[model samples]
Target: MFDIRLRIPSWHRLHSFLGLGASLFFAFMFLTGTLLVFAPELDWLRYSEVRASPQGSAKLSLGTIYDAAARARPDWDIVTLVRSEGAWFADQVTGVRPEGRDAFLWVNPYTGQVNGETSSFTIHAALLRLHEALFIPGRLGKLVVTVFAIPLTATVIAGLFLYRRFWTGFFRWPRFSSRSRAWLSDLHRLIAVWSLVFFVPLVVTSLWYMVETVGLNAPATPANRTVARDQLLPPDFNGARLDAASAIAAATLPGLEVRKVILPRRPAQPIVFQGDHTAVLVRPRANAVYFHPESLEVLGAHRGEDLSLHQRIAEAADPIHFGTWGGLPTRILWGLFGVGLTALAVIGIIIHAKRVGIMQQKIAGASARSGFARVWRGMGPWGLGGWLSVGLVVTGLALLTRNFLGA
Candidate 1:
């Protein structure tokens, strides 16, 4: 059933429907996403050290960062600190706050200094929200984006069909001296040809990402974890001791360093510690060691990297979406993609507008020749419906992509 929808130029029809409503918002998303493509460079410009990963270089133990955080908020549980592009930022969770305060503080890669507290993550964050759902609260954002994606995909496909004469139309520049409409079509086609090269890959990747992130195949948790998988690191549930800490270190955590020990505030939970493998870049990289809460005794360890294949792929969507793997080169590519796409959208409409004017002129001339009776008869069922269907879908697709995919 779904495959049947793909047979027609459905994406094109969708573009027309959503484009009119969301043109402005999508333009904003495109511009911001484009600029953000160089965010690592931008962040480097803002903060100097680019100190490259928080694994081995430790003066800032998880304990110390936790301590610093404990001092600052005193009442929040650490909700996993993000280690990305060599910078450490905390996403500490607080109890009373309605919206968790995004307490972004820099950690000393070597010194363990938790520096700077700021409430202004908005500069980098606002556009992110608008990019996703225009900041709509819930399922509305999801539904709108999904609907948009179909058309966006369609527009690109239809665009290729609509402009089938690639070579002749590809490089032709608009004559400024010509009528405004003539110029608009020329300009539109020119921009579309150029931008489409970069825009298509980016748009398709983004489409895959949108569907992937909201998908169901996440990593299996501890309950579903297997012995073959967990052997690399023992499970740490505070359930039983992995012998004692030193003994467990000898048996379970061989060849790796115990970077930081997360002391437990509760007896029932385990004292969790992570492993450091400076060598393997793609290794699950962090492993959990469980210990008795009171004795600080090692219980068992779990290898975070050893997950089922589908789970690993599912986990990759966020990094892929953020372009974290290929690093700066990826960002630059995506950044250019954003710019090219915005140009396409703007130029797409201009071309559409120009063609409509030409069609109108032709229709009027045909009316004169055929008389109103014949013209009306032609328009009666098929002619009007064709224009309406094509226009509606094309415009709809644009808006939906902007609202959902672009977001």
Candidate 2:
């Protein structure tokens, strides 16, 4: 009789254990990250009752929108007016109905009407907090997330090494069988192989954020300081005297799509129109044109293309991590693929637990048959050595990536 039971390797068990241990937390991350893909749309749904329908007519000026928002919430401090697929204004955390929460006001761009106001306590905002910091307080929460990135990357790498058969098999689907463990194994392997390409960018970029966050090393961004003018505007001015439309018209760059119009808060501060161009695929806010609030004179212009390589890569990380670089299609794909990571974690746990139970049974039976005190060990010194080797490899790879890519 030929026995064809699949024999799991020692390193394979180690990797599976690593993933299984972190399965629950990683699953939370995956689910929350998926929701964050459409965060803006989901957040807007929280205020759908008062949301204004899009009008076909000409939109109101940014100045008008700011005034309407200010009038709607007299106590609120209007900070920025954003013109996206929709028009909205954000105010500093004014603690209105929801005490200690930031507020966002949606405006009817055509008529300068304050259409809707939403607070920071919405489900979307909570999910974002969870995704970024696990709802933990302050920098400590960020550190918790940053610390986990390395171990998570190690698990992914170990999984890749264990599945070497994938390349040789040309990614063949494991044959379907009535065996439950075999079926799950096949499915797991299939998803793991397909997901490896995306896993690299996901983990590497994540590690980059973690490293930067802990202040081990961080990417440098070009300094931007608001240039103050000696000539002051009228002290009694109630709002921005120059409108956003005129400022944008005077300062818009070639081939850039206007995304947001930021009205200056102080007299010396400039009205900035920020947007994206096809050249910079990373951040949608890659291009900027600044205009003096009173004079409407061009103060400065900045482009993402002008940034240094390291700065550009750092900026690109956000869009790549969020899968926003390629628009809605890419975001959907990222969300879908993110589910596979969760599945790998879950299935790895199940498989490891089942294997542990089987091993215990085998050890018990062997002890009964041999009557030997220590004869029934599941794995000997060889397995311990294999685990040590795997650990060393993971550590080396992570450090190499951090030093080279980050530096």
160, model 2: CA deviation in Å?
Answer: 1.8
Per-residue CA lDDT of candidate 2, range 210-297, in tens? 8767775434432233567553333333345536444554446777666676654444666666677655555655677776655566
TM-score of 2: 0.74
lDDT of 2: 0.62
* lDDT of all predictions: 0.50, 0.62
Best by TM-score: 2
Point out where model 2 deviates above 4 Å: 1-10, 49-52, 56-61, 86-101, 110-112, 168-171, 174-176, 216-252, 264-269, 365-407
User: What is residue 387's positional error in candidate 1, in angstroms?
Assistant: 19
Cα lDDT of candidate 1 equals: 0.50
Model 1 over residues 297-395: C-alpha lDDT tens digits? 556665546656555555454445555456568667667667766775665555455555456667755433332323222322544523543454444
- Candidate 2, residue 349: Cα displacement in angstroms equals 1.6
Q: Which runs of model 1 end up more than 4 angstroms from their true locations?
A: 1-25, 35-64, 67-78, 86-102, 165-220, 223-305, 357-407
